[model samples]
Target: MEAQARAILEKHHDNFLEDGNAVPAPARRVVGNFNVDDAKPVARRFRSIRPEHLRKAYDQLEKLFQTELIEYSHSEWASPIVIRMKKNGGDIRTCIDYRIAIQLIKLTHYPLPLIDDLLIGFESVLWVLSLAMAKRLWAVPMTLWAKHISVLICLLRHFQWTKMLLGLKNAPPICQQMLVNCLWSFVRLPASEAAQMDVDGLAFLGIDVGDSAEEDLSTLIEGMTVFGRNVPSSPQLNSVRGERPYICDIGYGTETWEQLCVDLDRRLYRLRYWGTSVSLLKNKFGKKRFSHEIEADRIQAQSKIAEGVIDLPSPSTLRDVQPFLASLNYYDEFIESLPVIAAVLNKLTDEQIRSGRDLGRAMEALRILKRKTVSTPLLRGPDSQKSFVIIIHANPWAACTVLGQESDGVFIPVHITGRVLHDHKFRYHPAENEVVALIRALRVFRAMLAGTKLIKVYNRYSMLKWICTSRSLEGRCRQLAVCFWKFARFSWMTMVWPQSWELRLPPPRDKLDQNDDNIIQVTGRVIQSPPVRLETLGPRCEGWLMSFDGHAKKSDRWGSAGCILWELLSWDVVQARGSHFADVTVNEAEYHGMIEGSKMALVRGISEMVIVGDSRIAIQQARGLIQCLKPRLRMLLSEFEDQRQEFKSIELVPVKRGFNAAANYLASKI
Candidate 1:
């Protein structure tokens, strides 16, 4: 019967081998009981029906079946009618048991969903095959047949069927490769006995095995563990040194599949032994959860080691020397004693030390000497009699010296070195010695001038003249003279004369303008004051400016308002003030206001600048500390930085209240 079916298929295949439009005579002849070929004449009855016309013919056939004129049955002879309909361009109903054909083709071994997904283009063929498989009417592998049909459908859609049928059209190389791979995937193996197969059979269609052919089979067995037989026992397997047993049918050709299957069986045996060994090891040395107390103990030990509180012998040190070595906790004392120990050791020659019958006794003597030398006190005075002075170098050439005095009135100088000024050079001046003496004298004078007692100097005019002349001394000497006079006057005010007394002194004035050739006039109002109470102002009042000048054109007009702020404040906070000015741009104006406000705060010795403005641009700019980018604003920015150095700190704040009344008033007047 199979041979007969093959012959019939071959004949039909030849008929549609060229155009694919011609219906097989044998198949069409069995469509209905009526001998249409004989009655209507072959030429007329064999006329190919167009697809549109086939629909009408199918409807008529449906009517005939409904009227009981035709029967639908599970018989191969009944398939001829469907084939005739297909030949006539009609939609043939899928066979109810088409899966039987799929089984015969050996395509059922694969997962059905995978097969379905791969055969989406050949849905009709798959449907027929699925029906046959579900009904057990076919022994074919439904998945395998569906895959082939999918390739055929793809080819048919891409090229003319007529050319394909005639052999004039060739199937793509991929389609042929897929068919060969599917065939290899279909080969069956016995239940107990393993079969050899190629790696390609298990791989997806169109994939090449390449150098990973062996690995592919191993991976396949590992993935399909449930399907494989029990593994063999071996020490290699137990140690995970051997491959697992699982066949990978990943390539075409009979030999490849056979080799793959052989590899799979061997690998599985090894994997089984490995799994068992792993289980045994795990059971023997399994991890256990510790109680909180135990965990805490472990953590404490770890932290001690990390912090170097617990000493572990150094890994790089000689093992024999480890026992004799002391803990590193007394590092300072240990280092201090090393030189003394070396000196004592040098006195006794190595031969003499070795000659000592007991090495321990010799080592003990050396240690005693080291301890005595290092433990000796360096200072030999009472604690109250000790004094130290710290000299902090602010610049390479200058240092600020602060002295410490003992109860006996002895002064000691302590040198100060920090990361910032370690490499700095300071030139000691004679004035430093004078300042030190003056500090000591001031202390003694304060003690003698207790209460409101005042002693008039024998030469008061001469002393005043001397002090005034001393102030004119240049550089370090000049600074020293000023410090002496200031300290003396401060002592007088606080100790000698309790009443308000003023020494006649020159009034402070701005340095004469150096650029007399290009003098420029500036005009502005007193827009703001230092943000501090008068009594709280203290020594800072001397640096504060009463007003800021806004000039249109000046020799220093190129400078930024921000830079001017820094110059006036003498504080680093000026950098934090966002300010700039440009050529009449709104951004420039806003930036200028922000910077100027910050500078005003610094000049007033205020910790914060509260900038209040109705202009949204100015408010946002001030709030964000935005800088102006206009070319004209660069100079303003420079000026702001120059003026910022006077204040200790400055902060920016936005305000909507009348607190900025002065600034607002100035803006209006401008």
Candidate 2:
């Protein structure tokens, strides 16, 4: 493979392979194209030339000349060239500062494959022993007109590339399109190639570019695509991979099925954990449950160190270090300490080529990462009906977060993550760090936590709002405050002390200060599992009771809302408000009436009141039992929260429609 790569480099180093034939790109094929937004031609003078590196810059120009990659040009468009030394100090790189030129570039955008979609399902589990990338873009020829955009001003001499080169923003999508076309034209076996199979079955084909007919490494078909036992039930992309076991009908495919099942289960578990409204699938999931604690011995078999996967003997360059880090990054959400364990490798990313090569330290970090990946505990699936618990821990070096949920009687982890602090982050106040950690975790787990219940412990829920309102803060804190606005609805909450707490538990059959069979059955398993509520207490004001209801005709866009505030002792109405709405949902009308009732209470200077409503969803949201996620409802809830501050104590009570007839009649009469 190495010899084939060297041969390709020597022969067609500046050529792209043709899709039709197994030969070098025959002509100047402009796969990627761009147009200037305006008629003006952009030009800039050469800059950033160092006195000590002048000779190396000239040597780089000479190398490009010999490779025929660049030629003299008289184009009006010119980007300045900057010179920098290579990490080894033996060579120099001539780079272009294309900032100004990029302004006029009419961006040609194509949808590159998303990393999330690529890292999901069957593709992520495949074993890849070796992977290499050759400079295939060099073969993509530049059009005569487009070549002007590539012109660079070096020492007042303008030059342009005859082939595709770095610094062009549109090169990636163009190269992707060309490679896709080439693969589509490659020789492919029939999907049902049952008759073409040899008696000994099939062997995976490993292909090399620029290979001859006499070579054993040549696939003859021109390229290699990893084939599996059976097509996945879900949609999949054709990704290149090394040799893996294939399935045959002769009872030999059990291993492949077993491995696939494990991988598929792991993926589904994560999807469930990350989803906001996941429900338990009775038929798909068995009665099995994960332990509250993670045990290394119980991890799945596939997680163990596979033969060739984590064999990081020695990686001398950042290029070598990056791919392995990317492979481990797939386990980021699964392993909490990933950022900490790989801190040294992450620290090594910006190091010079050979100057900071700590092979021993890097290898040790990689080895630890391998073990961490294997020992990661399985996460509990999310339940939309249950609330989510977020426990955040911050130290000097890192911030860790754990997403907790309850199943049956025990609490289990849904997801775990850690973010290492470096540079400016280390200078934050301790409380500031905690807020940073909280907001970061909230954003990452928004998919699961949004529109779900969160524990409103103390004033922590309002911390974000406080930060946003604060006047004394640095630019970083202000930036975080700006980002916090995007997630304001997802994190809004408040708290109530235990004295004001109201809970309804099952009545015990027998109790003598002991957990009798029928009495003490309630096991206080998960601490935050109970559904606690609050009610108005320890307050002396007008005993006001507010009942609200909304009415809408069948299939009508108009509605009416009514609210009545009456003295609880006399049962006499003190004030009543009715409003009609157009093009509003029933829930919206109900909220309108609820808001009207609160306003009336505030006008009467009522410090404590009980609010009753018939709409269950709006009532729950007002009582903090559920989240208000809809834009309109969220706005109404915010307005209600603002008005709620005027009262010393308040409670939202829900009643059946039949029992709220007084308010209903008032609404329908409007």
Predicted candidate 1 versus true structure: per-residue lDDT over 13-70, tens digit per residue: 3212122122212110001011112121111001233465566656645553453323
Candidate lDDT values, in order: 0.28, 0.56
- The clash numbers for all candidates, in the given order, read 80, 2
Colliding residue pairs in candidate 2: 15-139, 16-139
Q: Which 10-residue window of candidate 1 scores lowest in summed lDDT?
A: 129-138
- Give the poorly placed runs of model 1, Cα more than 4 Å off: 1-540, 545-592, 596-648, 651-659, 668-670
Off by over 4 Å in 2: 1-30, 39-44, 47-68, 80-89, 92-94, 103-106, 123-134, 155-157, 179-297, 300-328, 337-380, 383-387, 393-400, 406-411, 417-670
Error of 1 at 188 (Å): 33
Model 2, span 251-329: residue lDDT tens = 0111243443433232222211111011121112111122124357554534324434555456666777788788776
Distance (Å) between predicted and true CA of 405, model 1? 71
TM-score of every candidate:
0.15, 0.41
